[model samples]
Target: MRYSKEHKNQTHARIVKRASVKLRERGAHGIGVADLMKEAGLTHGGFYAHFDSRDALVIEAVTHAMDRSTERWRKLSEETPPEKRLSKIVNSYLAPEHRDNPGQGCAVPALAAEIARESSKTRRVFSGRMEQMIDMLADQYPGLPRKAARKQAMAALATMMGSLVMARVTGNSELSDEILKSGRDAVLERAASSEKKPPRRAATSV
Candidate 1:
């Protein structure tokens, strides 16, 4: 049966959305194409109609997941006070809700390791999304220069992602919570300190 163009687009989006959650819940290689198609209520044979290859689907899924996360961060930043924007993002990202819900949380903590081993094209796609995330994070630090803000964002993101990975893997629930708290505190502290320091004046020649 021939599906209309709008219907095909909707079906393709549904498949990609499901794949995004499943990819995060399981590793990149954990689920097969057939299973993903089946979960989307379609046959494996129809996969080719929507995507060129499994790698293509994977790239699209990763991009979709990161886009959702970025939108959430952007909303949080807009709703928060200028002074507290970074803290709001950090706390929300490191919260227990995010840790316990891998399928619905940030892709970096869930798929970074797998993406690192993927093909160059796949890695490039992931890198581009990550750059968008980093730029969004840098915007939270309005007090710093562009270079310094980006550096701070990188460190904050590393801490948040690392803490989340540890929190999810550790057997002790208390330690997991502590890890989240420590990560949030550390990021906020660093941001606060950086904003407090006066900008250095360029050295003048004698």
Candidate 2:
């Protein structure tokens, strides 16, 4: 029996979802169509009906992972108090669990370097998703000007991504935690300093 259009869409979405996580865990090049399809609980033959080509599926998978991560952040942020949002985001993201399981974690840190060498279309999708994530993070600082908020987001994202990469590459767990803490403290301290600026005295005549 033929399934409805909605059923087809759901199946396709499932394929993308599974592929996205696999791509994150094992870089895009590491996974093949058959493996991804099998993981998605679909047959290899049905794959082509869902996507025009492997590239098309890759693009969709990237977007799917991005959306999942963003939704997770939103939920986490909402459940957490404002003051602890930064800590929550940083600590959880940099933890060993997230590092080891990129399949279920943020896409930027997981796949940014890999996606950079992909086609322009892939890069564009990655860029757009990153911008949205940064914007969400910037919104946490309502008091700061747009430029300042963007800068702060840049620091936080860069620190987290860089520290994670270093930690993973060195295969040193203690060093990884240290790197995470140092980066987190640096960004938080800078933000705190900005909040409590030193008072300016009246200029005295020389």
Candidate 3:
């Protein structure tokens, strides 16, 4: 029996959403197309109906995961006072809850390595989404010029992503926690220092 347009759309969404979480939890190549379709409660035969290929599904899944993370950061930044927005984002991202939940957390640390090895089209899509994230982060620093703020955002995001990767891989729980805390503290400190005004030079005699 043929499904209606709405039903088809819904099913497609379900597959993408499930694929997003599974991809993060198990890396890009860890799960096969049949397995993903099975988990989504659909048959492998229907996979082609929604996407042209497994690569297409992967691109869609990566986009979905990154978009969700960006939206989360946007909401956190919106709800916070401008002065505290950066700290709020940094804390929430580096928290233990985010660290322990790979399936629902940021996609960078989870999928960056895999994406680097993907096709050029896939890498381009990932790069575009990453740019959106960096731009959103730069918005939190209204005190700095656009270029300066973007530079700072790049540095801050790199630290957070790198720290998260290390935290997840380290066998020791205490070290993991310490890594999170250090990353959070360092980002906040760097942000604070960047916004400070430089001291005035003493007037020289003529």
Candidate 4:
């Protein structure tokens, strides 16, 4: 029996979606092609029909994960006031729950270490996703100059990612919590200062 084109497309999408979550939980190498195909309810032979190679599938999966995280951050950002958005994002990103559940959290920080060794194509996708994430963050600051806003966004993102990485690498739960709290406080404090600072003006002759 044969399936319709639409059905094939749907199956392919399902495979990507499933693969995205799996990739987060288990790094790219953690999942075998046959296992992934079976998990997607498709045959291993059909894998090539949907993707040229496992590398292609890995790239697609990473892209999908990035898209999912972006949407989640957007929704969270939209609901909160601009001033509070960074704090909320930091809290959520650095939380123990987010750290423990890689399948449902942001893939960028979760897979950052592994992605360093991935193919150039994969790294490029990751870099593009990071840029989009930064842009989304910059949108939260309405009155700031574009350059200042981007700088602030970069700082906040770096803090959040660094905290999560530290928490994941440390064995002590107390230390993990401290790392998250410190990161959150640092970002919130910095954002508050940014909001308060007056724009710099051209210096006049003394």
Candidate topping lDDT: 1
lDDT (Cα, tens digit) per residue for candidate 1, span 92-167: 9999999999999999999999999999999999999999999999999888889999999999999999999999
Measured by TM-score, the strongest candidate is 1
Off by over 4 Å in 4: none
Error of 3 at 34 (Å): 1.1
Model 2: lowest-lDDT 10 consecutive positions:
191-200
Q: Model 4 — TM-score against the truth?
A: 0.93
CA lDDT of each prediction against the hidden true structure: 0.93, 0.81, 0.92, 0.87
TM-score of 2: 0.89
Please write out the lDDT profile of model 3 over residues 9-112, one tens digit for every residue. 99999999999999999999976898888988889998999999989999999999999999999999889998899999999999888888999999899999
- For candidate 1, list the clashing residue pairs, or say none: none
TM per candidate: 0.97, 0.89, 0.95, 0.93
Once fitted onto the true fold, the runs of candidate 1 whose alpha carbons sit more than 4 angstroms away are: none
Clashing pairs in 4: none
- List the candidate 2 regions with Cα displacement exceeding 4 Å: 198-206
Model 1 accuracy (lDDT, Cα): 0.93
Residue range 1-206, candidate 4, lDDT tens digits: 89999999999899999888888888878868999899888789989988999899999999999998889889998898876776677788879898788898888877888999999999999999999999988877777899999999998899888888788788348988898889889987888888899999999998
Count clashing residue pairs in model 2: 0
* lDDT tens per residue, model 2, 1-206: 79999999999988888888888888878669997888778788988989989889889999988888777778889999998787787777777877667678777777888898889999999899888888877876656779888888888788878877776775657877677677777777877776577545789998
* TM-score pick, better of 3 and 4: 3
Better of 1 and 4 by lDDT: 1
